[model samples]
Target: MASSSAPSSAASTAETFPAGTPAAAQIFTTVLSQGPLTRLELARRAGLSAAAVTKAVRPLIEAGYLVEDADTEARPALGRPANLVRVDGGRALFLGLKLTGDQVFGVLTDLRCRTLLARHAPLSDRVPKAVLASTAEMVRELLTEADGYGVRVVGLGIAVSGDVDRAEGVVRYSPFLEWREVPLAELATAVTGLPATVDNDVRALTVAEQWFGAGVGLSDFAVVTVGAGVGCGLVVHGEVVAGAHGVAGEIGHVTVDPNGPPCHCGNRGCVEAIAADPAILARIREAGGAEADSIDEAVALARAGDAHAREAYSRAGEAIGRGIATVANLLGPERVVISGEGLAAYDLFADQIRSAFAAAAFGSAARCELETRPLPFEEWARGAAATAIQSFITEPNRP
Candidate 1:
């Protein structure tokens, strides 16, 4: 018997973005990020003439990718001088998933990267096949949610930790997942029947920050993540720097202590060894003799006036600070945004972090602004979705 409602299916006819001309995509992106502008302002911002902006906007407006409304308040007495134009965020949909050791997080977002709904599924296994199965299931659930918006889901993005080759759509190596050389994009496309984009989780999040969050309008900035892992994402000249080998920003691997502790990467006293959650937990257990099974327990112990626990966090903070100083010295970014799961304990050692950074930073590098933000876990998923939107705009669809 039929129930009160019907079930939603994952089957979707992937649609192509209608903006074919370079100028059209450029104009659409301008509206997507900084929009509701008159043709004059849009032309100025997009570096095009009024005639060119009008030419590029016609197709997008006809295809529903853009909408124009008369500025009733700003109207001149002569005629509808210049109307305001903006993107229709509800025009399309996407799915972004982030893979962790124990969980797979998924988010459904609109064309403008707005998170409409989110879902979490347990990753019981780390094998490529198992992870793919879990990912496909999550995608199906998100697709069902997308049915509510009555839009076709056009693209999929998967963000993984460790070395990922976005152009090649392969995860070269993921330490946490124990995955190596996984052709993630091809396999995922086969499973879910949507064009897929694969990227490093941190780099993908850096893209989101550059466009919609902290890094907006800054051509030079760095994103440092702490907690489960210490990762850095760099942006220079209005683009995320992925390095020649696609492993550019491995700040956590910087050697801070020559003889402090051994790292999983076979290095001694790498920043991650001292600052990552596992490292801090180990320090609390071994040196402090505290039975702190997780970072939360360690944080609680420190807050409860445990000197040993406090010392562990301080050491982690010092390592992180030194790492940031290295980034500043090398690239001279204007701002550094520090985030990640580890920041939940910022109050424990914020002073130590700032002190170490100040002492190590050199010359004008010391003037760089350090901003601390704690993004909700779901934002990572949205970042993955943003990458899909990026691929849609920059590159054509692939099976």
Candidate 2:
């Protein structure tokens, strides 16, 4: 799970992503996400003329970022077989890191966001300097692995659970880590010598889902994560919502019961206060004088038919469900993805979650599909890589 070896000196230079113009970047993204498309289909999906797509793709293809090939499997009944275009996954590499309170999860991914390697380092300290050293060491290990593929690692992305200013590459606040005003991106870049991007962990996960996982091709959806802390990531009108102050979709802080429990954000009965892993454990301990050292232990106690443990899980589920309904009512998303390490105990609370969601959802909002996905910390790291890929292709258009 970890290594004590110090990081070597950083790489001097890296390759650049080829998409420069917004139109070109948009076209590349279309192919990267909804890829292996014919020129006609790419043009149609991108809402651009064939000539425009061709012009945009030319530079990308020349740069080895895009590849064209015959779709023998989908060879038409008509005269000619159409060539499908797709991103070249081996063209460039990126490093992504998910920083948690106790550990750092990292991954090496290609241009198309395919994970090639993964590593983690235990975090005994939460200070910026310590975390940065651990992060740099992890990136060094990953970059060494990348050397095998004969490709340059172009960027590094760090996903932290907090209010992150992606545009500014700063972590404004991180309650879990007790950090404030940390210039994470600059520090990371200085350590690794790669362009670094910092973003909210859940929002970074949403970006990965939008590009490659459950939320692909869906314009309106929400990703609600339950675990040590409850978090939500929202996508509306095909863009992740960052809000005016770099914080949004914070359903975890929504007050589900005005008198339930105290939240770290200074609110009573907030969803996270009742539904987060620590909260469930605390409730179980309070109800019957039982002690669960970890969420897994709490799950096992509930599964063993302990009444207090079961009741605690039920309460957590209800709080989470209400928070989800709030999101549905406000956004009317087409789907909501419920995920995180907490899903390991989903069976214990599944019914309560559904029942509460059904009762609280407003009108047509109740019609929204609810999906449960189990994504480990590694996937969250992959999400961080996706953010790096996004910045790489669209940096020119970024404000």
Best by lDDT: 2
Question: Measured by TM-score, how close is model 1 to the native structure?
Answer: 0.93
Q: TM-scores for all candidates? A: 0.93, 0.95
lDDT by residue for model 1 over 1-399, one digit each (tens)? 122112245335456777777787778777777778889999998889999999989988898889999888886879656689988888889899999998999999998898999999899899998898888888878888788788878888899999999999999999999999999998888788788899999999998888778987688999999989999999998789999999998999999999989999999999999999999989888884668987889999999988889999999999999999999999999999999888899999789889999999999999999999898668888889989988887665444
Superposed by TM-score, candidate 2 places the C-alpha of residue 60 at a distance from the truth, in angstroms, of 0.7
Error of 1 at 257 (Å): 2.4
- Model 1 bad stretches (over 4 Å): 1-13, 73-81
TM-score of 2: 0.95
How high is the CA lDDT of each candidate model? 0.87, 0.89
Report clash pairs, candidate 2: none
Would you give me the overall lDDT of model 1? 0.87
